[model samples]
Target: MAEKGDFKHEHMADEANDNDTVDFSNNISARIKNPLAGIRQDVLLRDVEEFAAMYDLSDITPLLKKGALVAQNPADFENVEGLDDTERDVLRDEVVHKWRQPRALYTTVILCSVGAAVQGWDQTGSNGANLSFPVAFGIGDTDPTSPNYTRDLWLVGLINAAPYIASAFIGCWLSDPLNNYFGRRGTIFFSAIFCLLSVIGSACTQNWWELFICRLLLGIGMGSKASTVPIYAAENVPALIRGGLVMSWQMWTAFGIFLGTCANLAVYNTGAISWRLQLGSAFIPAVPLVIGIYFCPESPRWLMKKGRYSQAYKSLLRLRNHPIQAARDLYYVHAQLLIEHKIIGQTNYAQRILELFTIPRVRRATLASFTVMIAQQMCGINIIAFYSSSVFQQAGATVLHSLLASFGFGLVNFVFAFPAVWTIDTFGRRALLLFTFPNMAWTLLAAGLCFLIPKDSSAHLACVALFIYMFAAFYSPGEGPVPFTYSAEVFPLSHREVGMAWAVATCLFWASVLSITWPRMVAAMTPTGAFGFYCALNLIAFTMIFFWVPETKQRTLEELDYVFAVPTGKHMKYHMTKSAPFFFKRYIAMNKNATLEPLYRFDNVQSDAVRSASVTAYNQEHRKSETTKKLNL
Candidate 1:
């Protein structure tokens, strides 16, 4: 795809806009490709204001004088440009095969996904402990007649959400600086070591506050990996399978939830998992991740950002099929870096952090990323997962049945989440969110209403469990993985790490906020009000995604940068605040007067025209061979 599209644009540049040979800095040959060559002049004039509003005024000079794309290996470029139909098919197959290698995409997915599992362990393990811990630790005043017995709503909420609080404040922001200094592997290592300590502390605590303090420690480590893992995994794989690989982060999360529940099941009557063993079981995944993360390779793209071109090439070489293929992928990285050098000179950490909010497109990207993550937390899935056993007991099940039903729910969560691994890239992130949010809202409301029935009615209990499972079914693919996947891919490589870290911070903060409040909300108004609140959140999520989020399917990570297209910092506020966005248009042209018709033809406005149709088409085409077909396209 890179060869087919970039070559055509390069050919069009040479044929239509002949430029005089000019020497440029950084050994780049200067040539302004009139990317608008074949468009109608009237249409260009019609959308003149749109073009100017879309990009910054300050970027016009550099856009016009933009240097030509450079190749790391020129001969490999020739091979792609000269390929016949059969040769193209063979090459595509080879690319697919190489990407599927255990060491390449699969290994990256497994190691980074432990981040998700760590989250699941804390949540589900705690949920299982909730079954008996209140009584065991004298949490909520089992005997009103006894001395020192009081219902502490505020204390319970605080203890329940302690981990999320620590995660939001510490782990979330910590990833960016840790990533900057120690790189992705070091940050992940930091996360694992801390996660292990939190688990040990949680297991040994005798009182609720002790457990709360332990959870706080857990949040610190968990937050560290929350933002770092998905983008790290995404960076290592080809864009072809990027969604599937990144979604693995959530897949392992579901597995961890299941593991936590199973541990609960094993010790349910044995008197272990209630407070100690269930929390300690997080060590199962954390131990392996800590030992193995150091063995994983550093991101080639991160390497390029540091001016370590040789190491970047070597990393890509080990990941890709051949040195030529690695060089071709690395070429795009270098080309993007070279262009940025002309516009944004060496930026310190402080400057990059400032750019996250002040830069129009970066700000836009931040909002887009932040909104989905907030939606993910507020979507009510995790609430259902952490509170399912409690809800089961509320629905009139015995203690044993509630535990059994909770285990079943955990298994269902693990089973249902796999569909996303195949569908996310094909259906697109926004499409999935749009489809699932409505389903989640109604199901949650209906489940809450189920409580209106008699406690002894089997039908009511069954309906509640069914609603919870169906909600998970929708949520597993919807808000669950999409936030992590979408946030990882949207931001430019320049501030991608910082941007994603901020998104994760938003999630952690909200996760804590919601977790703390759910208990009090239920205690005050019953499950009905909590469910009603979740439904409202889902509706808002639908609206935000329908408008703000763009479909990022079938595009390379570098190509995705074009989606935002906001220029430099000088005129960013005007572009961001004052204008209606042209987000769907391809950002191939940067010239002041360039027409965008060639880049985004009339039929190609994805965010607007084809958004709904994508869900239907993607559903019909979801088979084992779907990946190969999409890549072959």
Candidate 2:
């Protein structure tokens, strides 16, 4: 009764429906497919109307309708009706002049920078203090022959590692509850209090144990602040330049490292109390962070999550340049959140933690975040960050010269980080990691080998410092910026705080391990062996990163759910089959025309239907070819 053509059309439509069902079942494939795509205009309008009514935004219902349309398909915003020229120009400026943001946004980023400075200064205060604190506390053991020598080494390491141990085990985990109840600004304020008190307490401590206890308390602040600041920056920033902005965390951390070294040098002349001054001076950064956090707006995403949509709108209004831009982002983020909630579902705290591993999409993000965070520790930057003065002393420099050399390393680190702000968004996260890791590997190896130079030779310290500075130079632009920025953006809103806690925990745990072990490791293996071990680790980190971590640059925090939804095995196989060969041919083999297809498809609403039709047609053609081959055979 049905004609052949009609039968074929029905069959194709049936196949498309089957495909859609399969995609929906996995949730992964459906997530990768844009939620905005193929959404009917009438349905979107109706949803917008309902959303406005539910949220008590009836006064802006007309604006909300237009905003929803623009949010659904941002690429077509220019053609979106009802947008005045001012609204249109603001959207255009978002793309063309990405950095031209509201002063409040820049202020928020700067405040976050100050928070990072507290973290860095906190870290390196112990670095300068490492020189004198052990002596003051009666734990100094420069003599290898002393009975207490081994015990002192462990004690000093334990003291240095105390903060990180606390951060990894206790402080990072607190971020979830702190952020949940206090909000970003509130959590940051709370952390700054701990940082302020701990630094002053460390300065006033009469003994090593007292100092250790103070540093342990410092970790509470460090972990929570570190976890929140990058997420705050990421949520506030536009995705087009998100990487550049969020990475300010590391850049300013580097600046704080530089300042710490300056404080070390500045107080070198202050007798008896110089180390105390060195440790307490870190409190200065915390002071600004505590006072200035109140000046910044709370993260709008966090506000939205609390069911305070009106407050979120008000917050976004301050962060974005114009009301329409604010409205668009608010509605867009809300739409994405609706879809995200449906897919992720609701869960208790424990269940959310479990879902991080149980959910396919979230599992990929967890693995990636773990990779980057651990890789940061594996790169061995913190070894230099925590003990560069001591390292310089071991390299045959005088105490003053060692402090100066440490200052040089700090200066190089801070200066080199400037490039990443420009490169991170444009050149991309994964590519920077790939490019810098090998360079870091060799430079670190070279620095380690430089330690083998005879102490009497003029070139010994020079070569050591040169290679160490070079290692820092390579590290500052790549690994330094990528970890926090990458980890901050990967998780969905539901898991963001916990996911970041997990990530920061991994980082600090390894940092604790490194700090605790490096003293003994260097004592047993010597500097060459110690540095060589981390150099090998750098390569290992590189391999893990190439296979596991996805490029997150330029994607919205909401959009990244789709990116991570891609199954891990398939992503790795594509890299092996396609990206590897293309890299080999294009860069290594010097081929000009080698092409590699992208792994993820970024399609707008119309392309979703087009892609479905194309897939169906292709399947039909492939079946015909197969049948002809079978008949011919």
**Candidate 2: segments with Cα more than 4 A from true spot:** 1-32, 605-633
Q: How close is every model to the real structure, measured as TM-score?
A: 0.77, 0.91
Candidate 1 on 230-317: residue-level lDDT in tens? 8888888776678878889889998888888888778777664466887777878888898888778898877766656556666876
Q: What local distance difference test score does each model get? A: 0.67, 0.84
Over 4 Å off, model 1:
1-90, 94-99, 142-151, 566-633
Query: Could you give candidate 2's per-residue lDDT for residues 450-493 as a string of tens digits?
Result: 99999999999999999999999999999999999999999999
Summing lDDT over every window of 10 consecutive residues in candidate 2, give the lowest-scoring window: 1-10
lDDT score of residue 335 within candidate 1: 45
CA shift of 625, model 1, Å: 19
- Give candidate 2's TM-score: 0.91
